[model samples]
Target: MKKHEGLNCDDCVEHLYTYLDGELTGETESDVRVHIEGCGDCFGHFEFERTFLRFLEARAKAQCAPEPLRRRIFKEVLLDNGSEAE
Candidate 1:
């Protein structure tokens, strides 16, 4: 099949995450597929996001935050910010 030359910025940015997550449907999904087939810039962005998510997952598994740290953050930030319920 022939490749597209470029995609409109809106289509590139808007559908990017959805397309990556396989959340797009119908015409929108088709549009993203067509765009990625040819647009190097957008494809690069898609690849980067995928790689980043993989890194985040691996890091979360390798070095999880301690429960005390979570509680401290909640008390210092959330409670300090007055987000507590009455």
Candidate 2:
């Protein structure tokens, strides 16, 4: 482990999302990277969060509805709105 530097656990928590998202740049980014690598708790939290984010990203991808099914849904909507689907 290297020096703790200016970032404590609290600072690490605050920067967690931004750091993981690759949004942090320059020294701030370097500091958080170093802190996570050096601190066991922070490293574990980073690992868990990164995994969860990957899971969410995988499940959250938009899939287009099939055109026939989409038209059926639109027809239902038009009927409910008192407009005939011609």
Candidate 3:
């Protein structure tokens, strides 16, 4: 990917996650947005990570911990709090 005026593909990739998470300031975010719009390779990488995060979110929502695992977590929390399991 060619280097843009404000950011290159490497800089864009470095800040990709922060950009996706809306953690960047206005100017920095704009720089990343402009770079991705002009750079096909960086844009592809951004899209792939976005899609992968969505897939993981969906999978997490569809699954649940087993009863034994849940109980074990509860017990651990109680122990950490210095409380006996009832």
Candidate 4:
């Protein structure tokens, strides 16, 4: 990818987060991918961001099941209150 024609690092940085989140589509996504693969600096930034995202995801997993349990408890409380209102 040519620096003059393809996305330069400055342009690619704007899309990096969106790219990591799988929010970018089609040509824009393709352009970022190509630029990251070819540019070491951009690739480094991508790696750091990707690793940080993985860390966040790992931390979030611990709380994932608790949200469902909390929701179920709240629903049950609501149902009990509804029965009392009958």
Q: Rank the candidates by lDDT, best first.
A: 4, 3, 2, 1
Instruction: Report the poorest 10 consecutive residues by lDDT, candidate 4.
Output: 1-10
lDDT of candidate 4 over 21-67, digit per residue (tens) = 99999888889999999999999999999999999989988755687
Question: Which is better, 1 or 4, measured by lDDT?
Answer: 4
How does model 4 fare in lDDT?
0.89
lDDT of 3 by residue, 15-86 (tens): 989998889997789899989999999999999999998898898898788999888877787565575534
As a TM-score, model 3 comes out at 0.66
User: Which candidate achieves the best TM-score against the true structure?
Assistant: 4
Whichever of 2 and 4 has more lDDT, that candidate is 4
| Candidate 1 residue spans exceeding 4 A from truth | 1-7, 63-86
Off by over 4 Å in 2: 1-4, 62-86
Residue-level lDDT for 59 in candidate 4 = 91
lDDT of each: 0.80, 0.86, 0.87, 0.89
Number of the predicted model whose lDDT against the real structure is largest? 4
RMSD of each: 8.1, 6.2, 6.1, 4.0
